[model samples]
Target: MVGRTNIETGKVTRETALAAFSYRLKTAVAPLVPCAAAMERLHRGARHRILSKGDHILRAGTVADEVFFVHQGLLRYYFNDPNDGGQERTGQFFDEGIVVTDAESFLARVPAKQNFEALETSSIIVLPRTVLNAGYDADHAIDRFGRLMLEEALVGSQRRASRLLTLQPEDRYRLFVETRPEIARRVPQYLIASYLGLTPESLSRIRRRIAGQVG
Candidate 1:
């Protein structure tokens, strides 16, 4: 699906087109772009899905066979705490250009403890894990893509752990503002508080302090 050819002809070969398109998608959907051909194959089969606010893309206790690349909108990842009478503890938020999925469920083929829900009306490209894995088996480049993606995922997990372990509520809020401004601007304050490991009341204090308005 990707590549270029003789410049004089001003036409592209299949290989050239695939290479070009795969290169473009790599930054956003890395592992899936094993090569121009593989990526094109997946693209042709890609399904677009729309989710309204509050819709759940995935639920706790269910296996997720799909991973979604956001075309537009926001998603929140959370877990229900039975001990807290089914309160949802938001773990993370994602938006356009982000990949939203229950990675654990996709990788392990087990039920996910986390829930993936739309925070706003959203459009996404759904990629079946089965197709991805089959591609990985067929192409060395695709296999490398999978490995690299996992490495990136691990790094992200480590960063979250570092934040939870070392940063105070106020500092965490500041960091969140700096790194994920869209989330802070769009998501509800209470959900943001849950992500920051604070109650809504604590979040209010943090916000007022940041505004230089706390008494």
Candidate 2:
């Protein structure tokens, strides 16, 4: 059992983390594999990992060997812009109940272009590629799940790319807030600005304008 100390209470919360992981796994996999035994077999080798804020689970130039399911806290997927003095440009934020990974890197066995970093103390379930591959080969439902996950990832990537290329900063921010209000609320303003391809000041102005309109 993997656990971390609760910062406020200074007590290990292993059971809480475990319970969250189990619940999230079931919620994610149950629709694809309704059978209890098959779900168990598919996730047989999944393990828990705890990451502190600023920890990099997957970094640029490294192949992603595992898929992570966020059970608690937040994660950021970003890449450094070489032309902009290696400025970190946020790609996406993964919060509770999200599955995260550099799918291309994991599938192609190539170095990742972006990094996966914990934005806060996070508990995640790690599914190793080897175990997942075995499950995929052995179970038809597991294979379908994998295929659907990859397709979703691809579609999400394309959508993000299109938004960045076509949308105005304010529109981008609005769409982001509309689609992922929880992430917008939880993430730092500057990081959110980066994700939307806007300056912090610009994002602040946009937020103020939006608030004024709402009021």
Q: What is the TM-score of each predicted model, taking all chains together?
A: 0.81, 0.85
Compose the digit string of candidate 1's lDDT tens values, residues 122-171. Answer: 66677788777776777777667666666767888899999999998889
lDDT score, candidate 1: 0.74
lDDT of 1 at 194: 93
Please give, for residues 13-115, the per-residue lDDT of candidate 2 as tens digits: 4455555655554455666543555556545677777788999889999999999878777999999999999998998898876777998899899999989
Best by lDDT: 2
Task: Please report how far candidate 2 places residue 97 from its true position, in Å.
Answer: 1.5
Report the number of the highest-TM-score candidate: 2
